[model samples]
Target chain A: MTEQIAWIAVDWGTSNLRAWGIGPAGAVVATAGSDQGMGKLAPQEFPAALMAVANQLALPDEPVDVVICGMAGARQGWLEAPYLEAPTDLIALGQGAVHPNMPDERLRVSILPGVCQREGGENVMRGEETQLLGLAVTAPTYAGLVCMPGTHSKWARLEGTRIAGFSTAMTGELFELLKTHSVLRHSLAGDVNGPERDGGFLAGAQDGLDEPEKLLGQLFEVRASALLSGRTPDWCAGYLSGLLIGTEIAANRNQIGTDPVPLIGSATLCALYARVLAMTGAAGRVVDSTEVVLAGLKAARASIA
Target chain B: MTEQIAWIAVDWGTSNLRAWGIGPAGAVVATAGSDQGMGKLAPQEFPAALMAVANQLALPDEPVDVVICGMAGARQGWLEAPYLEAPTDLIALGQGAVHPNMPDERLRVSILPGVCQREGGENVMRGEETQLLGLAVTAPTYAGLVCMPGTHSKWARLEGTRIAGFSTAMTGELFELLKTHSVLRHSLAGDVNGPERDGGFLAGAQDGLDEPEKLLGQLFEVRASALLSGRTPDWCAGYLSGLLIGTEIAANRNQIGTDPVPLIGSATLCALYARVLAMTGAAGRVVDSTEVVLAGLKAARASIA
Candidate 1:
């Protein structure tokens, strides 16, 4: 019954879980995802949850060769795979795997290791490892800065198949904290997106990156001026967005180190990052790295085959 | 009744509404506080909510003098008292009271203004304004730095009876967010206190304040290291506490202007701030500001009386 086994690939992130079923040639057959993100799932429950998705593909309980990526490989997940330090390369990933609850009856499952950063000091990245691998493949013709921007924006320096180094900025998370928890929330109007919104976000981002020293002090004005002087809440969001992302852009202008950085992520997300990057006079091209995740998944599956 | 009317005091904060029937000598004859804090009550409900407490004293409904100093007068409170700007004196406070539902109600209620700051760029402080006022009164000779520590740590500079400037750090809120919402919660062991545990709080605080340039980049390590390394979860609090307090301390080191900052707050809270302060070679003194809040309440009440 071994007619060259099909491919199994999964992307397990903090808030999302995506799985794909591919033919022998890495052609997509079926795909599935659920709100059962790694952040919310119980340790022992990952197997059953995975099987539920496999069932959706009608692939039965037989665990062909499944390769997983993201935070799922952290100590809290199915296994405690350590991160590879920066100046990391593809071969630096080594062979990492997590034996889930259904292990005895399982066919095969391998979880990828994330990156452990120790430049100025210690830092980490889990799911981005897979994204980087995908990035390397997708950007093969292109060699420069490959960035995956999200809650923690990641920038990877890749040459050929090797990931030279990577850095992260808590841009999105800071934005969330400032908006929801900080006093800045009071000044910001609820919605950040609308039609009458006269291009406030990019402008805010520009101003933020320009003057970071004034960042912490100006936070009050965003709210006060909005309340007292009637600044739009959208502007507040844009201003805050600017402060976080702009601070990141300014601080890492050297680490990211390039004239043009290729932003590789979902369309909307890449746009957001690109907008911030635009302020630095950095050239940016939005590339969809989704194919790379699937490609990396296929490559990982092929290794076992 | 008139003779006993020494000081009518109130601690009208966010989640709890409290009023004390103080004698001319500032002694509590009757104390009443309700779940009817500003957070729980609507703007229109302030009259009835406050009246419910005053009714307990059998005090006349039409006119009674009270000096309130708490979250009650915050922007989110029943009445939005204007924020007192930095480098401000008590005289700089906003005029007019938060006329409760009762339009002509003469139960003279003077809600103090929260502090407004424009340092570096952010604005913060509310409940601390009253405490700062109390500190000036109680520590008549005390000057330099006064830190009112809590979920949000407020660092203020008091030049005699006047407040020069202050800043609010989201240190406490960070602790809560990381412990409850972030990945750190999973491997977390315990608090930053106890004989077996000083936790990592002090160390974290020191680390945070150590260097301002590298502050934001180092935040993720607190959680990541605690999980991957032998760092305890209880230390997570300290690590976070250090980052926040440390950052504030470093940023305001100039504003604190090379002087031993004395912490003025409740005994327990003062100790915590002092412990962190000690690590920085900055001496600290705990002044029981509860009495000062009462005193400030008294003085405020006397003015209207």
Candidate 2:
């Protein structure tokens, strides 16, 4: 059964490493992950970290192709996979993949290069590019705006299989920073992502959409609302999240255009973005990040094959 | 000369304590300060911290009236002064002052209450209210919008000597957080507050003012611009500062009205703000925060007297 495995697919990011064992027929045989992210590993540690998971599947002695994407290719990661400038063809991403030397003869890893925008304002994305490639593979002719939300949310405008231009928003990072490290932290002491879907979240999103420039002031109102309005901790958390997300959406509203913005990410995060996008009168279609990442890696593998 | 000290004006905030010795003739005599701020002091440590500075100005063993403002009056400070609800008469702030028991017989400290707005949304300000009082004392008939720029930048609408309504923007804090904690820290390394007045600051501010909702995305550009445009560290610092401040100003543009907004803060900081405010088509009159605080404390003293 293990002999059926043909290649491997990995999404190696800053904080975590996820891998899926793909069969010869393109079916996923097994999947695994660890906290051994690129940020945690030095050049020497990359092979062992990958082998730690590779050995679990009792991979045969034959060489196996492993398609990797994300921070693993950063300058500080296992090997530097230089950024491919934007307006890049998704099909060409495979050409940008750099092969990192591995101790195990059985594992041949190709790390995909992240994309960089050198003009306008400098911008870069590592893993999301793979996700976009995956999205491209899923719908070969799909074109419009694509948003992939996470710690560093990426918004891209795609023309067929080529990414025309893209922008990254610090919404997720800002939300986390405000939730855990700010004065509003006192008011949001409880579950920062509580089950309670308080109206404060929608209200905050609406406020951000209505007046995105006033965002910093609106954020202060979270603490103020807690102090004066006696808003619950859950509501405060929801409001802050809403405001950050709403502002991000409003900031990129023009990019969304008339097309249904395709949101690629985990269900929880995508749901939030989708809901907010709908609130802004834009349609959103959610796609699981795993599906897109796998499809993206598979596409890269096929291209290399 | 020491005995000429009629009273002590103290601005005890979260991180530091600043005091001014006032003569009976209403002139500032000598001044001193200590690192022991509200955040650093326990209830028992407050008096000693105050004494550390108070003792420097040697005097007879007689009680000296110390009018204190800022976080020293917070629930967690020397003594809780409670909030004076907004639409509050600046003159009444002194009436709401609370006295904390002191072991040093020579110090009779009166801590002023903060101002809180309960309507619309909950908002609170401790030290800024005193500055408003001081501004009022300087210009008794003054009326219009006042901007006190700091960690929690405040904007207040005043009707004569009363605070009609007010709002706080976490501009300074956000700047600090992004500079020190966020990924932008890489580009903003070295002097967080550099002497360089790169045109980048004004440019960033103008961009923020022009399109505030695009702030989160624009912030990413700081990093992008650095990576691609090779922007210097000083330029990055100024640009970030401008973007945050400009966005804050853009958000609250509706409140600026036609009058010259009074900016109360240190000369260096207020100058940056004044410049930004001017860029936004409004005139900004810089008022030294020290002068305003002292005048505010003096006004409170007279009201109590």
Candidate 3:
């Protein structure tokens, strides 16, 4: 038998593009990605990019419904999907128009809308709708604290599939600032323990979890006093690592109310956040975001199917 | 009529060397500076840098007792003066060298000692001993928090001429890292503000101070939400201002512990920090560092005179 038509799922974002080809049974057969992220391209350019990737699987004219999420469906993405302000459903993440430039004979696509949030007066999240969907789909039991950490960290309080409340933390940028430009630079020396996750980083994160409020002033002091008074740079890095993670712990301490915190990210990042939160005497479970992203993509795909 | 010597003072800092010659009553007779900074030259080079400035004054080696301060007295300065651990004194700050190179020559130089500190477990400061002196001399009998804002901000508890305790905050570098490298950068356009103090900077600082504690999380939202929701770059700058100054407010909330907070800096930086703190119903005062540095230099000279 010849290779059959397959389902297409994608998680297009700011700096990256990821797509998957799934069989009728929902198992992924092939996948592709590129540096051509939505943030770099205009909203109209996404169709051509998606089609370029779709052509890779020799997709036949039998209309392949592209169930796209992430930043690809943002206002600046392939289609202008308006934000669905929380209390969402497939109805909330609505379907937008197909590519006006592409021929009807080549493809049929549906871009997913993102979610908006307003809690404690006003707060919002757009592209994270899918990531939240992925988390909710993968572990319906993941009801407490779910955090997706990266350059922009999103912490959500999930009560089942419905998101109760959420917040974002810019821990990644703070880490970069201290290392390169601040007085703390003298203390960092740009080199630290192996893989950045040796016992030192974990131990430091634990330190943050314990005392978040008093750590900001402490963060700069570690690197500063070290360089001035002859302290090691590695300890400085570990100290800074503690400060940023510690600040996040303080910011999220309240939202993580009641249930244990579950961290979702790549193994290394998850361990770093989890281990640090653990140090605060708060138990945490690390989950894989890739799995959640895939599960989220599958959920979006099923909706279109 | 020959130009007569009045007072001799110096801004003998780490990397910038400046000295002034005044009429007998401390009016500028001649001013000089050179690349021959304490940071650039060895202990032996301090004499040459001093001479380079003195030669510019065209003065004979009279009984002019020159007062020097800043990094020139550090372990690596013109004379290796050790830091006086806190609960410091003018004597401690006055323990610098008399220029072993010229004390016997009737030419005099008194190097000032830096202050050391360990508060909230451990954090110390040097060089600020002079700035703290500057603050006290300029705004004597003024009680409340005095913030000397810079790359590393020193928040001091100044009581008359004595520096009781102080804390350092890395607000500047943190601003750079977030604006240039963080996801938040996507939200910030390339302008720090339109120009000088007339621009949107103060507006941004005001918004930041409005929600000081929620700063870290809101930072990520500015970028991530902007990418998905289309928030402007200007707000990103404001968010950055908010994160940094907001952290400062929380870090220095003790400023309003009993009395009003006094801000010490150039008019611009002090105004910004003052406005942010003002939002919390606290009073503020801005004093010029130029005057403080000069007055600090003068006090240092008379103590050895």
Interface-residue RMSD per candidate? 3.4, 1.3, 3.3
Q: Write model 2 residue lDDT over A1-305, tens digit each, in one string.
A: 45567888999989999988888788898888899999899999999999998777667668999899999999889999989998888878888888889988899889998899876567989899888988998887788899988878999988767988899999999988887788889889976556554587898889888878778888999988887777888888889888988988988887677877899877888988898999978989998788989998888766663
How much lDDT does candidate 3 score? Answer: 0.66
Considering TM-score, where higher is better, how would the candidates rank from best to worst?
2, 3, 1
Worst 10 residues of 1 chain A by lDDT: A211-220
> What are the per-residue Cα lDDT tens digits for candidate 3 across A120-147?
4245555566667777777677667788
Ranking by DockQ: 2, 3, 1
For model 3, state the Cα shift of residue B163 in Å.
Answer: 2.1
Instruction: Tell me how far the alpha carbon of residue A143 in candidate 3 is from the true structure, in angstroms, after superposition.
Output: 3.3
How good is the docking of model 2, as DockQ?
A: 0.75
Q: Which portions of model 2 miss their true places by more than 4 Å?
A: A191-197, B60-62, B103-106, B191-197, B257-259
Q: What are the C-alpha RMSDs, in order, of all predicted structures?
A: 4.8, 2.4, 4.1
Compare candidates 2 and 3 on TM-score and give the better one: 2
True contacts kept of each: 0.15, 0.88, 0.42
| DockQ, each predicted model | 0.22, 0.75, 0.43
TM-score of 1: 0.80
What is the per-residue lDDT of model 2 for residues B1-305, given as tens digits with 9 covering 90 to 100?
A: 46478788999999999988787788987889988989888998998899889877664465789999999988888889989998878987789899899888888889999999888557899999999998987887778899888888999998778999898899898988888889998888876456564677998899888988888898988887777677777889999989988988887787787878899887877988889999978989988788889889988887663
